[model samples]
Target chain A: MELFQNLAQGFAVALTLTNLLLAVSGCFLGTVIGSLPGLGPSNGVAILIPLAFTLGLDATEALVLMTSVYYGAMYGGRISSILLNIPGDEPALMTTLDGYPMARKGRPGDALVLSGVASFFGALLATIGLMLLAPILAGIAYLFGPPEYFALYLLAFCTLGGLASKNQAKSALAAAIGLGIAMIGLDNSTGLPRFTYGEIHLFDGIDFLVAIVGLFAVSEIFIFIESHGKKSAIGVTLRKVTIPIKDIIHCLPTMLRSTLVGFVAGVLPGAGASLGSFLAYMAEKSIARDKSKFGHGNPRGVAAPEAGNNAAAGGALVPMLTLGVPGSGTTAVLLALLLTLNITPGPLLFQDRPEVVWGLIAALLIANFVLLIMNVPLVRLFVSILSVPPNILLPGIMMVSFAGIYSLSGSGFDLILMILFGLLGYLCRKVGVPTVPIILGILLGNKMEDALRDAMVISNGEISYLFSSGISIGLWVAAIVGFVLPIFLRPFLKTPPRPAD
Target chain B: MTSDRIFGLAVLAVALFYLYSATAIQLGFLSDPVGSRTFPYLIGAVAALCGIYICIKPDPDPNWPAWPIIAKLAAATAVMYVFARLLKPMGFILPAAVASALLSYLISPNVKVSIIAGICLSLGLYLIFRAALGLSLSPFGDLF
Candidate 1:
């Protein structure tokens, strides 16, 4: 009953003219940004943080806008995947297994509609899960002390070690690099600089936005330049955009199963949409009576991954909102943005700032509906957006990124740092080191240390306090299980089951 | 594969240097029981261990970009760095225009389209950021 009251209040806030306009514009921009290959939700949200700040939006409105974009980008990624065999974002890799083949079979419109419908179902179901589960999780999180929090952070790291890259050693190396970077600047506990090397600018630590833009956006531009203006072969012509009712009914079970699988994976701190969708695709393939049709223009293949990824995106938000631990790269960016707003997200966030928390929830539900409406009838229009050449689009993005970073920091050195990080990002990508875990490490490293220190202080430096509590011990056990479980499953989830490109 | 192994060695060197720096961090008497340097020490150790592992057995060599592509990437990066230096001195529009023009030209050698895009992006972004959003980006430095 109280949840109903809070949600009603949230609706009142989200329905206002300013918030509604923000959501609509964010959705539109997110779709366009997400439709572009090489720029995923993390970059989209990261680049837009400065725009939100420049616009002078209060924290709540800014969050609403960014979260809307986050959802929009996830929804928009499917358009390119289905029409052109290229996955717009990493998680969309599974969609191309059947989506491209279906498009090649001259039912481009149908493939898109099915994916769109699946995305809509996944997003809606996941949002519903977030709404229901976040409160309960938040309540449980209230009991978490420093040891529990430290254990949770450890679990996150262990999970990332398992999921961030194909090679655990490489992923561990990336994470260590991130932690080392985070160790720069003044250490608050001791009032001493660690890696400043006598530079005055290093007193305040590296800006998260600068690191993010450089890694995700600027390095992407480098890759685009390397392509020398190569365009995807999007030759599919769309006549109509409707799925038969029977097809929708047939895929309903696949959608439901994927939503559950995605939601579960997403709620965990390391299993993101890519894993969720990959698992869902594998599950669907194994269970299907005709396994041969799994990747050869099967509509269920399109539906399962689409639904799973979108649902997982929603699921990823639960830990971020309730426990202040982001489950995925994009959510990590969102958590950083929230921190910038002086809003520490945790169990206390619900008690203290129900408006911001519940309002974001309400906005997400509405935004998913908006994406469904926009994507179903206007997907062809969205696809044509691809014709905007990278030459034009890429420069415009660079300008936006430059202007945003400059305006936010008013520091030229941050710009210099951004480019340097961009080069590092390019090098990392070239070396096949996944950068997401590095970013996650940077985001969580300080907090993890603080939690550990706090626990030690509370326990009077007792080493055994980390596992003294049941919750902490359970988290440790879970972390061990998560790290070991993926190795056994590697045979099935081997490198996304991809064929030669 | 050899390049990857060398890269792993480079990582190991960085880790060693980081560990050295971590040792130099001055600690206060009343600092947290775990202390600040312990975390960095742990990070350095993890990095060193991983670095050694990768050096011993690295992934297959990823396809490095050709010389021409590398040249183009370098030019693009140089343009962005120069744009940053020029942004505050010359303001948003002029540097943005020139940088966008340079970038677009790099992508496509067509001068006319590049120039038009440069103009549109500079003025248009100026309007969006300055006029619409009220961000304090000067149109012509602090001359106004």
Candidate 2:
């Protein structure tokens, strides 16, 4: 009843004319950003956060807009994956495994529709789950102490870092690098700079936005430059977009299953939408009667990952809202946005700032419906975005990223740092290191350190405190299982593991 | 590939430097039972270990881009670096325009089109940020 009351209150806030309009605009903008190669959901949200602030939207409204963009980007990413064989983002990478081949078979429209439907279902199911689960999770999370929280974060690291890449050591290295990046500013406990190296700007630490812009957006620019204006051969059949009733019926199970898989993965820290989609794709391939049908143009392939990743996007919000830890890179960026508005996310957020939390949930539900409606009829418009030459698009992205960052900090020094991070990001990609872990490390690093120190201080410097509670013990076991289980599962999986995106 | 191996070793070197730096951080005050250096040291050690492992056994050969592609990448980085350096002194429009135009030109070698695009994008962004959003972006001074 309380949850229903909260939901009603949330709907009341979210249904306002301004909030609804912002949601629609966010979805539209998100689609554009997401459909464009080299700019994904994270980039869209990061670029827009400052803009949203500049619009003078209150915290809840800003979040609603940003989250709508987040959902829209998820929907938009599928378009390029299906049509261009280039994934708009990491989660969409798996969509390309099946979606692209299907498109190339001259059924681009069908592929788009199937994936769109799948994304709709994924987001829908996940939102419903969030409505039911978030409050309980937050209530439970309220009881977590420093050690338990540390264990939980460690669990996230082990699960995400371990399952994400083929090589555990490499993922761990990426995580360490992220933590290193996070340690750049003044120590919260001591007030002494850890890695400032005598620079005034370094005192505040590397801005996550600067790092994300360089890592995701700027590095993408370098990639686009390397691509040298080459265009994808768009499948020209231009058939009317239609999914047969039979095909939808066939993919229904796959979509539902992947939604579940994606939601669970999204709720876990470190295991992001990419993992969810990948797992769902693999699961579908393994269970299908004709495993060979996958990757060759199976509708299920398109459906599975689309549903999984979108559902995971919703699931990813759970930990972020309930526990104040992000399950993925985009959510981490979202967390930064919330922190900017002094809206600290944690268990208390539900009680103290119910409007912001419930309003976001209500807005997201409406946004997903809007995206589903918009994507079906306007799919062609998004595909046409592919025709825009890289020259124009890249320059626009650069200007936007530059202006966004400059507006936020107004410190050109931050822009310089953004470039350095950009270069570092490019090099990391070249070397096969997963950048998500690094971003997660930076986002979670300070908090992880704080929790560890608090646990130690509580137990008078005894390491045993970290392992004392049942919750802590359970987390450690889960972490170890999360780390080791994937290696064993690797052989049974029929699909070749995608290289870390 | 030799490139990957070299990268691994380079990472090891950086990790070593990081570890050294971690040790160098002064233990300012005992604000917590475990000092700030502990986490950094752990990360440095883990990173160093990973670097060593990677160096000993690098992944399969990565396809290194040709010299031309590398040049393009370098150019892109340089353009961004210059844009950042010039952002405050020259203001947002000039550096953004130049960078955009230069980057666009690199992608498609048309000077006029690139310049027009650059100007359009800079001005458009200027209007959006300054006029629409009310964020004070300097055309030529420290905004702060």
Candidate 3:
């Protein structure tokens, strides 16, 4: 009953005119962008970040808009996976196995419907998990100190670097590079400038919003140019959106199991949705009674991975909100947004900002229903958006980005710097160096430095003071595992025939 | 092997960059332990060590170096420089529209498509940034 009241309160906040408008816009745009190949959820968040920041939106409004896009994109990604045999992000990779086969078998419409239903179920379960887990974790988060936070951030970066494919060294190098970038701007303690190079613009530090635009959005344009904006398999028009009831019933158990698996993967600090989806797909294949049907046009195969990925996306949010640590690159982008809002996450957050917490929760619930209803009937709308031709779309997105940045700062220099960063972002990505750690490094570097310095000051420069509590020690261990285990685990972790894009 | 060595060499060069910055940064008086130089220097040293490891034990090859990275970087830099020159002189939207259109040429297969794409893109951006958002962009420059 109390849950009902809280949800109602959350709904009241989320259903405001401004939020509803932004949510709808975000959902529609998210679906279009996600349906396009080579653009993933992180890229979506990163590209649209400037709009969110410069729109004069409140934290909750900005978050709701972006998060809607985040989940909405997850829903839209299956379109290409089934129809084109391409997954935009790693999370959508597993959907291709059965989805594409289903498409080839002349039931592209059914496959699309199944994917939407499975994703809806998976995301719902995960959001419910988020609603339950976040408050409990927030309660525990209250006990965390500067030491604990420092350790948690360390663990997150380490774990993320660890998980990168065969390129762990470069990933580690990327983290180091990220930390350095994070160090740029002014140091908080002595009012000292760390790496600003005497530039006043950076005195307040590099804006993650600008960085996101440059990295994800700007880089995406360069990539499209490389492919000349040509899509090999144009999406097919679907006659209908609903699958037979038996299809949904057939995939029910697989969906449920994958949701659980995905949620678990998401809750962990660094495990991304791609891993969750792939793992779920593998598990479904292993457990199937009709094993021979595993790879070619199996409804269960389509359901498990698509469901798992969506669920994992929701799960990844738990740690990002309750803890300052993000579970994936996209969540890392959201983490940057949280800092801009001045709403420090961790245990005290729920107590201090119950409305933001509950409102986000409630809005997601609404967004899920919005996604399902809009997804099926409007499926062709999203595909049609893909046919808009990148020649038009790519240039247009660029213009918006530049104009938006110009409007936000009203300073030509900021705009110039934004483009510079955009180029730099393009280069780094092409080099296969991860961009999130850099953003995380820049965004969290100051906070981490502040925490470290304060902890040292409080402890009179004794490094050992960082491990004063059991929780802190455990966190440190987690960080080490995050950094080290991925290197050893890489050889053992199964590499899919083709890695998810 | 070629990409591996290149990456390894790139790593080493970056390590050197870090080291160079560490050594060059002025470490003022010792009153502040964490100075402009301390963190960079620490990072420089650690990065160099890692660079050494990478150089010695670089992984096997992935593929031909993604050559498009160079073209993309060049185009982006050109766009940035073009915008900087235009923003104050030409104003925001017109120069932006032109530059964006030029950028479209960089993306689209044909020049005709690029121009058309660029114009439409500039229009949507104008709506979102100037009108709906009520942002003040440079409106009076003569770059156009």
Point out where model 3 deviates above 4 Å: A229-231, A234-237, A498-501, B23-38, B61-73, B139-144
RMSD values for the candidates in order, in angstroms, are 1.7, 2.6, 2.8
Candidate 2: residue pairs that collide: none
Q: Candidate 1, which CAPRI tier? A: medium
lDDT (Cα, tens digit) per residue for candidate 1, span A42-137: 888888888787787888899999999998999888877877676777788899889888888888888888888999999999999999999999
lDDT of each: 0.86, 0.84, 0.75
Give the lowest summed-lDDT range of ten residues in model 3 chain A: A492-501
Sort by TM-score, top down from the best: 1, 2, 3
TM of each candidate vs. truth: 0.97, 0.95, 0.92
lDDT (10s digit) by residue, model 2, range A1-501: 788899999999999999999999999989988888767898778777767766778999899999999999999998877777677778888998878778778888888888888999999999989888899999899889999989888887787766557777788888899999999989998888887789888898888778877787787777777766454445334468875567788999999999999999899877888888988898888899999888788899989999999999999999988988788878878887887788878899999999999999999999988998888878877778867777888888888888888878888888888888878877777777877778778777999999999999999999999999888999999988887887787666444543221
* lDDT tens digits by residue: candidate 3, A1-501: 866777788889899998888888888777777887667888777767766777789988988898999999999998877777778877887788788877777788889888899999999999999998888888888888777888887877777755554566666676677677766666555555656667888777777677767777776776566655344664555566665579999889999999999999888887778777977888888888888886688899889998999999999999999988788888888887788778787777777777888889888888898898777767777766655666666666676667666666666777677676666666565556666676677667767766776676677778898999999999899888777776777666764563122
Candidate No. with top DockQ:
1
In model 1, residue pairs whose N, Cα or C atoms come closer than 3 Å (at least 3 residues apart or on different chains), thus clashing, are none
lDDT of 3: 0.75
Instruction: Please give the DockQ score of every candidate, comma-separated.
Output: 0.80, 0.73, 0.46
Docking quality band of candidate 3, CAPRI definitions: acceptable
